[model samples]
Target chain A: MDSMLSTPRAPRIAEQAAQWLEVLQRGGAEERKAFAVWLTESRRHVEEFLFMTAVDRVLEDVDPQQRIDVEHLLTQGAGKVVPLPAERAAAVSAGVDRVEPAGMRRRSVMALTALAAGCAAVAVAAWGLLAGTGWEDYSTVAGEQRTVELEDGSLVYINTLSQLQVRFSETGRDLRLLQGEAMFSVERDPLRPFRVDTGSAVIQAVGTRFNVQRRSRQTTVSVLEGAVRISTEAQTQEEGELVAGPQQSVPDSGMLQAGEEASIVVNGRITRRPIAEVARVEAWRERRLMFRADTLQDIAESFNRYNRSPRIRIEGEQIAARRFTGVFDANDPESLVAFLGAYADLAVDESGDELVVRMK
Target chain B: MQTESSKQTDGLAGTALEKYRKDLHRFLVRRLQHAEDAADLAQEVYLRLLRVENSEWVRKPQAYLYGVAAHVVFEYRMRTEKEPVTFDSEVMEQLAENPAGVQPDELGDRLGLERQLERLLGTLPPTHLAVLLLHKRDGLSYEEVARKLQLSVHTVQKYIFQAKARIRMEWQRQEAQ
Candidate 1:
């Protein structure tokens, strides 16, 4: 080769180094011993060996998919004319129902990329998954809030203690709100209805701003800006009859307008509030938790959601029965306790793992 | 001398670096003086050992290894401008073995190597490129590559070597630029 001619002895060492790599990879004890002797001959041998191996590693790091020529050849041999991944992804989002062979192959590749050692491959595929039916699950911790921009240009403001699984099919944008609350600022698409499944019901919207909160006893839907269609799951006739004493009374799921809210219970029935009570419902966003004459125990639980240590515990029936009305910082437990002490004429005790409130 | 299995990043047990790690650590400690800095440099030496593309070049791997460690010490000196460290003549003598200083750039690190590699990989001949891809990307053994390509093992070795040589040429050329 011209390269060998340009550098005569370097090539010889290169071959020698390559041979040693081969031996090191596969050869027995005798060959390895022979290899150790060969390395003793020159300093260049080790350096060249290092050079080859490092470059090889770099090559290994890059995806074979990047080599368009090779991928083209492989695709042809498989008896298929394949479009590039980017092109196929674009077609998919443009409402093309036909799945390209390459697109399907890429889907598996994308899945493998998630689990594979090659992180870069996964990164490449992650961006393309927005167009495909690739469902991605997202969650936020107790004190953390996250905003995710969906492929359909919808923005999901994930609230604390929330888990959501999102899937974008050709016809619709699907979401399953596993727990907690999320405020969605959806982008309007006539072709697709943005839907959230909360086990009890499915809230469908063409484009709207709304919040879905899954509470301890029931799932609540509060519409802040636009109308959302609440379709509760159908309850069985026998179960309904047992609850209603041999009378089947089916409750209808309805749409909630801006400043309207609804709660869906276990039997797939809804309780509607005429007004959303927007300021009270959305107060957590401003860190200004609003409670009106709530029980001391209930208020403590609200404050505890934002605090970690020194849990709030109301002592005695007198302290627990006290009415509390205040807008306090969600994150500031000290301020809320201080407010109770000053205004409610309550004795506050900070001792040994609990913040205790007692009737003074 | 036989070394223990290495605890390096690549996780190949019983590498020469693993066996003689204490010696290498002591060597670094002597020059860097600070136990932590020496410890870091010693780990870097092991990492480099683990990353050795061709294990064959390590004939007098012990000597060749010290050569790498000695060079790392020099590079460490080139950095740490806040510290006025002196390199004795003996240390300077060993520096002659290593001439492959990475090309300088504004980013001053991996970006330069990536640029140089990209340019060089493009310039390499098809045979050399094929061998490089097979050995590096495909992670094929020389015997396997030989079998696949219908060539002798020696010829495959030559291609791998040539591929390496061509890359080195390109890197050196970048340095000259």
Candidate 2:
């Protein structure tokens, strides 16, 4: 095998496979016909195509959190301000471009002002002081995770495909989890409460660590450290300033202590339960997914969040209902694929656009 | 155990097999080295092709047939061979690394591969790296990437193809080592 790979024909075959892959992804009917003819020309062509496919799968599986910031690298390479698109311009100036030297600090501050104006739809009057301040927006793309430290010494562990807006005013520390999941470790401040609004629910905590995951129709809150009071009513602007007061127990409000979890539905229904193991729920911070007899459907959904290609698709209801218990690296779907391949009752079809699982 | 419903579901694959059975058998006989295994390998390839959700999407049936045949042959060698294949040494190393003899977790291997790709990407020219990342990471089209980078669409495609070729070569070099 080593001898075969060392031959000059190997690199040529690899280059042909790469070109074929590109054509298959972006080309029209004529190009595909050409590819099919090329694929059938030799056995070496077939082997190289499979090998390149594996390499492309590995590229797709790379953890988005570890991806190098392309725009930042390009800017550094150019050593001059390159014109950025509008939405990206805001993120660049507010987040990554802040690390520039003193010479570019003034320009970044000006960019921050522009960002503040752009966010005026959601920002209040107090947010006008965002220029050169701690107010900012943080987000992680698909399969990406990040931990950010706020000005008040609080930590936010943002999960994949999440968006968060932080507005730290003199009166209160307000955070809005616009989408996806995030864990907030709040700093103790009796005067200002840390509140996270998930569109459907508003959770208020004081000097505690809690996780809030905003799904399509429901927001799930799991308290790991201290008690958090959740209000399922419509969010008011002044809600962020309400600290630990005597009226904490409102009619539409419920308190979840450590080792407790709650699902607040869209229509203001809160179902609270005791968490068997809080650590399992928080395992995502360590990039591990721990499942206990989870259905194949749910497992596939979780894995799909991190992988872009060869998506796991359960074809039959019986196969989808099968129970799987294991600990898998969140970014590695090959492990799951191997497990499925070993199961006697299941058949995995990996030839199509998705990895389809069916009952044998 | 083949029921009436199973037969109906296998209609498209049965047609494909009828058309390409001779070609697949001949190809397998050459690759398997054991001519006796050729017939069984063709049957395995047929079964796999039957599993495809939609055979109609396969524009070129003969090429698709050979593709499935190649996959079956590869798996046959993997199952029958005693000595570990050197090309898959990375996976073999992963299996051997676990002290508890548990199933090999792909996390460590994936991380190592990611780092290797990162280093290889760093060595690429700026234009090649940018074009590759913009298309792959940012999900931009070839036209959009060309527009953003002020390069022609054909150049963008060439850069991407070359970048992947370089990565493939790097992986081969490591495996050779």
Candidate 3:
């Protein structure tokens, strides 16, 4: 049935509505006058516009189960004449479900990659289906750090060059640390346990403070507050077993106590170490990065988190092996490098906007 | 609302500087949605203005100050990798409940009308479309559009009027078809 909006004056009325919306978005006195003219152009124009807008308002307000006819709407473009198809009516409904699957389960690694490619990951994932599963996505570009507050009130502070995802439900909070490091301050939610999936294995925590670093196939978990249970798909049965020895069942799965670190290699080998100041490992929250006796290469890489510029290349093995420790604000890395050059007798050379560290 | 000249003079003596500073900061905070960051950048703007060698070049002081703030915001966005800063869907859903008392029937009709207008807009030639977008989308005045595109005001107005009439006719034809 042709509606009231299907009348001959429909287009003019629609134009009037578009004009008003435009004026509202870009407010100007003249635009306001034009909008007023559109409104008072004719009684029919006014009535039709009101009718169409009311339908839109209803589409927005009513049952979310209503489906949208995106294909029909795409064809109509922005015209106001034809009645909204079932798809158009349900467009908002479908959009709501689009976010659920990924948000519900593990956000696909491909989803994160698409996100890095400047595609709207959340929006696209909300609108369309993602390719891969079991991969969580987390990303912070150079000189950028992000903190994501989980549904359970736990905060995850991601350091630079990091991407990860946390999928939490009544079952548990599962995280896929795709790449980079994240310090998690988990809230005390005993019912829903927290687990981080680092491709190879999972780091599960129940009311714990810890940091997880994922580099390619290798994953590291450092505990600070409460104890964390690091397990693989194999060790799920041995709930009470403290598989401490090197050649235990799920090769790398082990328990890490407070101030302890654990690394899992690709071949399922796990190593644990003691860390004194866990704050140094999770310094991204305070906007300060700390490096303890790291190689010059590691230090430079670390500095890249704070300062994106200065491609520092240590000259010889001697200089590259030299260790240093200093505190720095996230924005400034120039003085830190300069200070090193002065003390170590190394030359700080600027070659095409890049700071090179070599023998003087 | 003081004169630009007075504001410029007051900026130097740090007299009205506090008030201007607060107003500009508030303006940016609302626009950017970051209070602390806005205040920091606002301080930078004032510092730059104070340090400017030719502050008197700004005839329209409020416009110039806004222009500077806009530029600063632009530069800040440029310096950082773009993050997805989206409106909260839940909040938006909540806001959609009443939508500031906009009549439902009227809003629906307007949406349909908007769609038709957009379709009509698509049918225009590139130049006509540019004129329409600049005039309507960008809200550029006839004179401003002419200045921006290096055309006369008459030419810009003609393009706009023609574009509007053409779109109106196209709508009529589509309705008939």
Candidate 4:
């Protein structure tokens, strides 16, 4: 039996559950009735519901005994969210210094595992790096761009509101995109297929260069050279179909040709289109964002990627559809918004780090 | 080594009874803040275990024993007044003055969060409370909890779920508040 069908491989359901749990936790009235209805619908729903409920329970029972060090737990986002003071004391009482070795071990293991994931498509021994460490993590706020070099010779240009974990293993290299977009310039090694894991899907290179971007719950893969195979778990080798095309929404098996762009949606739907200009697609490499005719919401979201400051606020559908185009330093999205505000017939106000924009 | 006939031996009784006695006693001592009372409840765990029919029928001895101990603690707390244990004074003194980057506007956020947690914790039933304490406070395994309660692992998990749902309701109330 295909694991996809057997498991009901619906991340949408999981996401829905998480959202409903959040809503219930946050006391959203609309979700309460919906959740109750869903819970009583089936025994399986109740079981699935209970798992997340356990997590919520763990979060609420924040132990004062564990309140020794707020910094470590809060920094790692590891423990349940508690008052800063309690967290700090817990950290101290638990002795954060004692957990350092264990934390390091976990981090190194995670780094190695990420590396192994990269080499999944290609054959490579996992022994070489003995210890994986010292890869700088770079994250851009809503609309920003920065270039970073990995331990391996490859260079990565990160796009707005994006994060990538760089791990170089003896086998090859791996990159996990926690949030945003990145363009990778690979140092070609056919023996070690460079791989990228975004939140939505995983892409393995066939000695090719490509750019992967993760937005919301969608992953966009654009191949610049050779070919890259993208797969969702739903269409993996274990499934009836070994090689899924652009039409298949499964996670483990989709192929993309050079100069082609493909996206895997949140609901496991895939769409592919031919790229008009590779340069436009990889504009972040030169610290530029060319939206052509993109929605204002997308433009604002792109700007939000650059920094926590200069928050973009759009009111209603009236101004959201307004298409934007121009060449601006992706590093400073606020300034771009300010520049656009000058003539776009949009009222813009900059207060501290927040930028509010409304149709004039 | 833990033969049925060896129950009367001082070494076996001391080692077997003392394992959870001190820990359970210590937990009770903290919650009740009365060493004598905690000590009494700890003794009750042994008494209850000894009274179980064909106690030798228990295969997982330690698990069964702890389950009995946890129930005693739960009953003891419920039967007594709720003098909720709080963070120590030294801990409280250190808690003053929020972290450096908390921002001036967020000074009262911690107080609000505490209020929220208090309301949420209040909604859970005593057994669910025991489950929370056993799982979160003591870090007991599901098997241990089930064995102690004379229930299956699924039931223990259900108790945890019930506790969580109640907390979730409290969190919802806090959000509205």
lDDT of 2 by residue, A1-360 (tens): 234423434467777777765555435457656665665565456555655555555554332332355555566553333445664666565674543322132232233334334433433453346433554789997689888867655789998888998877754677888888999877654334578888777898765678999988889999875567788664644644333331244577887776789998988899999987766778888778888999999899888877776688989888788888999998888789888889887888886668888888
Candidate lDDT scores, in order, read: 0.56, 0.62, 0.51, 0.52
True contacts kept of each: 0.14, 0.14, 0.01, 0.02
lDDT-sorted candidate list, best first: 2, 1, 4, 3
Q: Clashing residue pairs in candidate 1, if any?
A: A39-B59, A39-B60, A46-B57, A53-B53, B4-B14, B4-B19, B5-B13, B5-B14, B6-B14, B6-B15
The TM-score that candidate 1 achieves is 0.40
Index of the highest-TM-score prediction: 2
Report the C-alpha lDDT of model 4 over B46-160, residue by residue, as the tens digit.
4554465653314333324444544555456556666554434442122222111112112143344445555566566545555555444333445544544455666666666
**How many angstroms is the interface RMSD of candidate 1?**
12.6
- lDDT of model 3, residue A266: 76
Candidate 2, position B137, lDDT: 46
What is the DockQ for all candidates, taken in turn? 0.09, 0.08, 0.02, 0.03
Q: Which digits, one per residue and each the tens of the lDDT, describe model 2 over residues B51-164?
A: 656534256534465446544554566667865544453542332232121212234544566676777677667767776765664345565566566766777777777777
The predicted structure with the larger TM-score, 2 or 3, is 2
Estimate TM-scores for all models.
Answer: 0.40, 0.42, 0.40, 0.38
Candidate 1 lDDT by residue in tens digits, A126-164 = 435555646689998656767776765577878777899
Q: How far in Å is the alpha carbon of A170 misplaced in model 4? A: 4.3
